[model samples]
Target: MSRKLISSGSEFERKIGYSRAVVDGDYVFVSGTTGFNYATNSISDDVAEQADQCFVNIAQALEEAGSSIARIVRVTYILPNRDDFQPCWPVLQKWLGEVRPAATVFEARLLDDAMKIEVQVTARI
Candidate 1:
């Protein structure tokens, strides 16, 4: 099996040394992606907005990796505040509820204070 790396054109990937997603054999593993719109380099302060953006980023990475958001097999969410998690449920459900992939949410400090959420996913090609 060959390996392929996907990038979302974020300079952070180059500076931090990471691919937005990696493809190996039958799987695509997306890295922890934040709310920043890679194109605009803008992030919403609202948690729900951030969550919505996370899905967008994930979907793009998955597609580039020959998969789709519908193919996600697992999802991991990182939040700076445990309290912010619930507010994001609607957005999350809208994206992944039907797919029903294995999911988890964690409260941890992110690299940026402005970032409220980071999402990572794994999918099969």
Candidate 2:
């Protein structure tokens, strides 16, 4: 199949020149997604809440890519603080408990200070 781009209508997609997700052949590659509520353009201070929102954003992109979170084969989590990772476990379990895709985590600075967590995933379409 030809490559397809999925957009979330986030201004960053325009400014940074990246789609929310890209579908190529049997796989869909989702971009690193943050917790900012696109509707409100605001983020929460709570890490867990941010984690949950990350999944929400991911699910939307996957859906647009003709896939679902259940189809995810790989996942990567990025956090600005290592200590913030544990608090996001319950939220992670809530979204990925069954699918349990191969995962990795990294502690690194994000583009914005308000972003506590970012998630990226690859899924089958």
The best candidate in terms of TM-score: 2
Runs in model 2 lying further than 4 Å from the true structure: none
Candidates' lDDT values, in order? 0.93, 0.94
Per-residue lDDT of model 1, residues 1-125, tens digit only: 69999999988899999999999999999999998888787999899999999999999999889999999999999999989999999999899889999989899999999999999999999
Point out where model 1 deviates above 4 Å.
none
Output the worst ten-in-a-row residue range by lDDT, candidate 1. Answer: 33-42
- The per-prediction CA RMSD against the true structure, in angstroms, equals 0.8, 0.7
- How much RMSD separates candidate 1 from the native structure? 0.8
Give the clashing pairs for model 1: none
True-vs-predicted CA distance for residue 28, candidate 1, Å? 0.3
lDDT of 2 at 20: 94
lDDT agreement of model 1 with the native: 0.93
